[model samples]
Target: MSETSDAPEAPGAAGPPAPPAHPGVGRTVGRMVLALALGVALGALGTATHRTLWHGLPVGLLVALALTASTALLCRAWAGLGTLAAAAVGWLVAVQVLSMQGPGGDVLVTHPAESIPSAWAGIAWTYGGVLLFGVVAFLPGRWFARR
Candidate 1:
């Protein structure tokens, strides 16, 4: 009588391990949401504490720009710089529009030309601060991801 083994055969050869899950989508979305939420919350708090913090300093605008820039950077896509530039331009345009909506739309419209320099200055400051924030956030983000 031949003795036949009843043992099951193992995998022919352990197939290449499955690729690691792409955490990019979840990480990017989570970071974007958290950044926006934080920005809004901080803007509200700053506004409450001192309206000037939000109005005169353009903190909200800067925060929005920085968040936009960082989100694009984190995506590791080709559109990062373009997105940042576009956001800056959009913010500048929005500022112009808001300033034009002055009290009864009278003050600004009456002196639109005069307000251009100041409006541009404010936008410059906002974009500068946002760019700085993006640079600061990028390194730390990479470092954190490495660990």
Candidate 2:
């Protein structure tokens, strides 16, 4: 009769264990900074550049994409950062909105100086960016660590 022994597998025996399902504090903070930086860059782009036939579409679209991807990475990297993630995105949106305003303006925020309807549309577009970020950061995902 053969006897089996209970023992742990050696390093690499399992072919490198999966990375942690949740990122640590450093990683979370780093990602948050990255998100903030990207937001700032996009905001600057909107402010520094003139709106063409493309209008603010290029800036808005880029912001939406960068914010969504970075915030999603933050949430997926760490599971407990729902509020933080959402708030970070909100802050990003706020910065972008405020950037739209000029040095001396009665209104809260405005971009490219459009008419009433177009201005309203721009505001909606800004919020929609936040919404997309929130959806990606808050929605439950299918995959998680085995822990």
Best by lDDT: 2
In order, what lDDT does every prediction score? 0.43, 0.53
Q: TM-score each candidate.
A: 0.31, 0.48
| Model 1 CA deviation exceeding 4 Å by range | 1-6, 9-16, 20-55, 77-118, 121-147
Candidate 2 residue pairs in clash (backbone atoms < 3 Å)? none
Instruction: State the lDDT of candidate 1 residue by residue for 34-101, as single tens digits.
Output: 54444444333322222123446756445544444454454333223333334334434443454344
**Tens digit of lDDT per residue, candidate 2, span 30-105?**
7666655655554444333312226535554455446555655555555445434644554566556664545676
Superposition TM-score, candidate 2 onto the true structure: 0.48
Worst 10 residues of 1 by lDDT: 43-52
